[model samples]
Target: MSREPYRARWAGTDYEASADLVDGRLHLRLYGSAPADGFEKVAPGRFVRAVPAADCSAVWHVTTVCEWHGAPFLVHTAREAELLIEYTGGDALHAAGLGLERIERGVYRIWVKREEVSALSEKLVKIVSR
Candidate 1:
């Protein structure tokens, strides 16, 4: 599959970093200092740098599950995937939820939509700022 690169402004700098899929792996890199504020992806190939409110007590962020190795286990926290492993019946729903697209003997990725991430983050920020 053709993957696009994700870009975002480093935690506190104007410089941006690129997160790309290299050899079927997520490779995030920048030429300067590391992101101090940390970051999370809001969408596929899109990232957002966290901005903390004054005296913020907590930080809200989303995580991506690119690949997992659990031998018929693959839990993706991003997009819609499937579990391509061998499992017994009466638990199809439970097993399928273990994958993002298709899990086969463990190994895959996951990504959430931009709208969901943005909305969730916004809600958390409001609560934290209060």
Candidate 2:
């Protein structure tokens, strides 16, 4: 599925990053210098940069399951995805609690509408300014 990239500004640094979810993978890239400052999909919320900048050594994994209400919840395991409540039961009642979208049979990805990143940026600005 095609999707617009999610852009985010670093909380206290002059750096920015963008994430893209494509073909069941999340790709992230930093616009500034950092350990892992390349365009690649590593882990859900982790990045690693090689010391030589060409070591090409890294590993990443996404969580396929999460805990909610003491129960195992199947999730698509992506930085952009939320809790997939379909496993419990694709019933309307469950769907209402947490928006659920089936990515495939027996697998689902949580639905989190595009958030207003600007609002979060503003909040970060306040915290940093203090």
Candidate 3:
């Protein structure tokens, strides 16, 4: 397993994350604050209207797992929209020789061969760590 750091722009926002290639899977952990609108945009309309953060805004925590080269890659799933945007912009799967598909609204999936995936993962780790 190798640890790597990556930064990119998503949904007009910048994010930082650490990635690891383990057992042929790419594991990602994203770090960032919640959107300016806060939980009002994320939570149900009724819930947001009823409950507002008076003292402190709600923080965001997202976790997602995707298959990479037949291996499962676990990712911090915060910033759903932003992550999709970045993926489309060719940041995550760029040059990984992976096939990208839109699984659903604001969601995407990637497919790649094991050898290519391993090579790309190593390259990404080196680039980000530098």
lDDT of 2 at 69: 39
User: Model 3 over residues 1-130: C-alpha lDDT tens digits?
Assistant: 2222454333344344444565665444433545343323433332111111121122122233344444435432323222221133334454244455656554445443333332222122222220
- Structure candidate 1, residue pairs in collision: 66-108, 66-109, 74-98, 78-111, 78-112, 79-111, 81-100, 81-101, 82-101, 84-103
Against the unseen true structure, what C-alpha lDDT does each candidate score?
0.33, 0.35, 0.35
Ranking of all candidate structures by their lDDT, best first? 2, 3, 1
Worst 10 residues of 1 by lDDT: 118-127
lDDT of 1 by residue, 1-130 (tens): 1121222233333333344465665444433333233545555555444332322332232222222333222222323433222332234455457544334543333443433221111111112212
| lDDT, model 2, position 29 | 44
RMSD of 2: 12.8
Error of 1 at 106 (Å): 2.5
TM-scores for all predictions: 0.20, 0.26, 0.21
**Over 4 Å off in model 1, which ranges?**
1-15, 19-62, 65-93, 97-101, 108-130
